[model samples]
Target: MDQAIQGKIEEALKGLFTAVSMLQDAYPGKPFTPDGRLVGDIGEVVASLAYELTLNEGLTKHHDAVTDDGRNVQIKTTFGTSLTFPVHHVPDYYLGIRMNRDGSFEEIYNGPGHLIQAQLSGRKATKTGLHGGLMAMLKRINQQVPDSERIPKR
Candidate 1:
């Protein structure tokens, strides 16, 4: 289980980088920051999309970047359709950065409602019994799409 979670965290980080690059390309010269909230650049956006990594004896808070304005961004990444939701509500907006087999990235949006908002604002999105549902959903999505087209570089 530890290895699996670590692998997921590594994959998430790689994907986060790709998403950041895409955001930078899209925004051009705009400065991105990650302060209190992962706010600012595309990299920060990618960081925001990441999940909090829990290891054997440590907790890793994954985030994007911070700006002088004090706004944090959660960049949710995926390889396929932007229509897919998250396995957890750890982010604010779902910035879908679909990666191509040829080493390219595409940015898309899935909207922000329950996922990040609920967690950040002290709302509940699911119960303990329903935890497996997200894993199942992600697994199904993985089975449906080609590995080469997944957003992050896994």
Candidate 2:
């Protein structure tokens, strides 16, 4: 990356981290979990910007965003190994994103909801049970799509 571009990326990341920290302090008792929903929100923002999708705000029944081609996408984020999907309400597509500790994406997986559900049908719904098989499924799905449709590790 160009030095100037790298500098700008660092500045933006610093701002994001500062804002998350402030929110954590302001809402200390809120149930935002380990990082106060910072990681998940950042992952959504990254996916929205990268994939050029409109993010759905407020309460939604299933999906997080709609693609330019009108596909309903459910976005899920994890630090390294875990991914959670709603068993009953599946979207048209599921976007599994893994983020680094610094909030940058480590990998991205886009696949149909049915395929993912099939893979997890008789398995435990935990990180240890789901990580390997889900990752393999993502890899196969990624291979079937164009480069623009997938985000590989950096």
Candidate 3:
């Protein structure tokens, strides 16, 4: 089920990336790249029976999509099932896409901030230490750049 959900999320992100890429291509030097960074969920659930059952449960996933050009996207997914009782609920899948300088790609689910940062930095996170390194890099970037400049100043 996880694999299937991952596939669906990936597909959705690809479509979004393509549209964004087109806009970037149409306007060169406008600071556009498929490798751009984004955070947060594209969608959120206002009300859910699952929350009622799980005692106000909430979830968010970042980096749900990436373009072939190295753009990164965050996605939030919600699962809805036609059945109730016995607690049968579909899982909401979040995807984070990272493109390597070597042209490789990695998609992560339910990742931490450091892990996502590593991906954005063209590093593959295979160990806990690597995650720490990624976090450090992210901290540095955050400190160096103002919030307004972080995302195209718009």
Candidate 4:
């Protein structure tokens, strides 16, 4: 990562935190959290930089970015404890990350798309609320992936 670009991103993140704090102070107990599309956008930006992905145009089908080696990837990001991938299409690979407060992120899952999907199969969220698999579960699945199968960052 370029230091100049990284420094700018860090500054922008600080500004975002400031805004979130201000909203919380003003609203008092009302949740003015950034999630859904906004959080997704942030995830894309972070993925493109940290993982060196070439981001696709707005809302492309299946995958969001392509790797340097031409692998299609669906990037998932969450600020909360869990992430839910869309049921429609799983890309060639999956990269799941958790955004931290300090503008850094923790990679939760980086492995084949099918593997992650397999974990979600036939489990009704309401049965035990499996609708959204938790991060801890994802982490365990991630361990099953071999390093050679993971997308390598340059």
lDDT of 4 by residue, 34-76 (tens): 7888788888888888775799998987788998878899888
> Root-mean-square deviation of each candidate, in angstroms?
17.3, 6.6, 17.9, 2.8
Worst 10 residues of 3 by lDDT: 80-89
TM-score, cand. 3: 0.29
| TM-score attained by model 1 | 0.29
Candidate 1 lDDT over 11-71, as tens digits, reads: 7656756776788899989633222222123222233343232111222233232222332
Which should have the higher lDDT, number 3 or number 4?
Answer: 4
Q: How far is candidate 3 from the true structure (C-alpha RMSD, Å)?
A: 17.9
Q: By lDDT, who's the top model here? A: 4
Task: Return the lDDT, model 4, position 56.
Answer: 96
Q: List candidate 4 stretches off by more than 4 Å.
A: 125-131
Model 2 lDDT on a 0 to 1 scale: 0.64
TM-score of 4: 0.88
State the displacement of the C-alpha of residue 43, model 1, in Å, after optimal TM-score superposition. Answer: 8.5
TM per candidate: 0.29, 0.62, 0.29, 0.88
Positional deviation of residue 28's Cα in model 4 after best superposition, in angstroms? 1.7
The C-alpha local distance difference test score for the whole of candidate 4 amounts to 0.80
Model 2 residue runs over 4 Å out of place are: 1-36, 124-137, 144-154
Residue 3 CA error for candidate 3 (Å)? 1.5
Candidate 4, clashing residue pairs? Answer: 125-129, 125-130, 125-131
User: Which runs in model 1 stand beyond 4 Å of their true positions?
Assistant: 1-62, 67-69, 82-94, 110-154
| Candidate number with the higher TM-score (2 or 4) | 4
